[model samples]
Target: MPHTENHATHREVELLETLRAQGGSARTSHLADVLSVSEETIRRTVKVLAKTGMVQRVHGGVYLSNTEALDPVGSRLKIRTKAKGQIAAVAASMIPSGSCVFLDVGSTTAHVATGLRSHRDLKVVTNGIHAAQALVDNNDNQVFLAGGALYHVEDGTFGPETIEFVERFNIDVAVISIDGFDCETGFLLSSAAEAALARAVTQRARRVLVVTDVTKFGQSAPLIACKPRDVTAVLIDKLPDRIFHQKLIEWEIEVVVVPDSKTGKTR
Candidate 1:
């Protein structure tokens, strides 16, 4: 069939338009059975839509891209303050004194930077403007900011230049945050440019630790930052479902579940 101006297959266009009208959430298996195709085909279709920013993939399905706007950093800091703080504390405790560390941009990572303030003679390199600022305010640690174009939404710097700078140095440890995690795709972030920079940092680090809240599990973002196998450890508030947990363990990924102290509960 001749391709239409939309540049999508007829089924793809049909699915997108239907999702646009009825909302993007749909069951892959149900769509497959309804369309008389395999579930893998449905997943592929959704991935394409997600990459093009036409849809946002949720835990069990996809959602309209515009359903919820990306929260600002300040708002995000408030939303998951306790969980993020605990994750940051756990991440900080893992780092040895006077080591070189790479911190990625994100509210959670900013918390980690705050936790690292008391550590002496630490060399901190980061792409996050907020993390650099926090380190500077502490005035006790050495901080290097990767220079590049600032992504306002993410409040971080990223580009080829920044990635090149990160590639030059070998880091003892790297603490990263992601928007999502999946057994098949590994850690996921919202932007391709950010993911590229993150991958560079991950490559240079001897030990890579991913710090994220449990809510990140099961979500799929546009870019796959790094595979679980690329990292040495994962620290999250809690594990999600049993099947996903088992999958990570099967892959030999060390999972650390941090409990919420206030509630004294595991999320």
Candidate 2:
């Protein structure tokens, strides 16, 4: 007998093939219209694809998954140090004194950890080894490391173990870093394991803030970490285009465009 085919899986495969043919970007609404399902359903399916590394979620749609590998963590750290530093400073300012916060593991989140080192009586729970190292070096605040499988590329820990640890604590805020964001996909990450951790952290926090640079906009990653509607705020280096800005407003997500003090530029 021939192998049975699941219609949902079949549709998803068809969608991926379509995305590959279209140069890697498609509007969510358009895809929904074509698929004859609700946009929410389409979005959820896309998130699964992102987690599996088969497709990248870009602004307004998804991208043909990239085959080019990312650079070493150390190299990436040097490339975006300044922008990440500024983003970290802004993210740190959002935390109230003496609050419990969850910090994601990434260069930008590491910057936030550095910026927050001086704040007194703050409790920080993190999975990033670099972030924990930064806090340990400063020795001014309380820091807890969520132990799990370490992914060298992110210089942090993730997996089921980390998810369990995060669930045990309720955080006042979560500052997450994203590989990219589009009005459609909200927040994207490079790995499915990282995206799982992000989703778990977002659920455990009272307020979730996505901290990223301007380059994140219009770009897509293989994993969808969160929907644009799930976040409370988006802190970026520049404002996105008017259309995307309006879409975010419609979703009730507050967009904070922080000017780059060094260059005095706005998105």
Candidate 3:
């Protein structure tokens, strides 16, 4: 399907969601008014969405034709909507233009890629194809993918080459995901190769932000990819145990406790 950076397309998607939420039907003028966009833009979006079978054009409005098609990313997206969206939004806001970032693989990190779509002049290196696709979605960011074996389960690259490939870039911020986090044991990973790749990026970046949902807190994994001292900060849906928080402070690592619906800054 054709894509554009036009704000109208974004509005159209939002309009469709609004329509679905409001009994699956809405007038074009209402959508235009809600989006603060021109009526012409709404008409154009409606036409396109209608052709795609995403919406049906009625006499003076549109109705939902079909919900989004099911796909691999769908289920993971549903797992932590509020937390991931809030974390991604805040993380995306933290990125500066022209900054070089390293994004690791995971559903949460993919959301970070989504948040980064609007950024300009970014150098984003990633192991996840989905994350890399998201970084360059708007065609404004520079994206690089790690070369190696594909780990379908994680939807990313791995093996020795992927680890070595990541070591070459000097990243500004390394945004990584986690399988487990324990205040006493530090951060953990499910796969050794993923851990190796993450360790390389975390060590190389000027700063590191560990982004994960609350589910990772106190979780267990075999590989200890990093410790509190290895990262600049951790971003999560809520604070972990106090001992965990104390250990981070002792290591000079910042902790950012975010709500499931709100963005945040390090505290």
Model 3 misplaced stretches (Cα beyond 4 Å): 1-74, 137-139, 259-267
- lDDT tens digits by residue: candidate 2, 8-28: 255565575456444456888
In terms of TM-score, which candidate is stronger, 1 or 3?
1
Worst 10-residue lDDT window for candidate 1 reads: 1-10
TM-score per model over all chains: 0.75, 0.72, 0.68
Poorly placed runs, candidate 2 (over 4 Å): 1-69, 137-140, 262-267
Instruction: For candidate 2, report its TM-score.
Output: 0.72
Clashing pairs in 1: none
What local lDDT score does residue 47 receive in model 2, on the 0 to 100 scale?
A: 88
- Shift in Å, residue 205, candidate 1: 0.7
For candidate 1, write residues 1-267 as lDDT tens digits. 413222345566556545543444677766676677887887888888777555777765766564321555656667678888998988999998789999988789899998898887788999988788877745457888988898665687889989988887779999998877666667776656777888777877899998887777776555567766678888888886887788778878788888787776666
Q: Report the Cα lDDT for candidate 3.
A: 0.73
lDDT of 2: 0.73
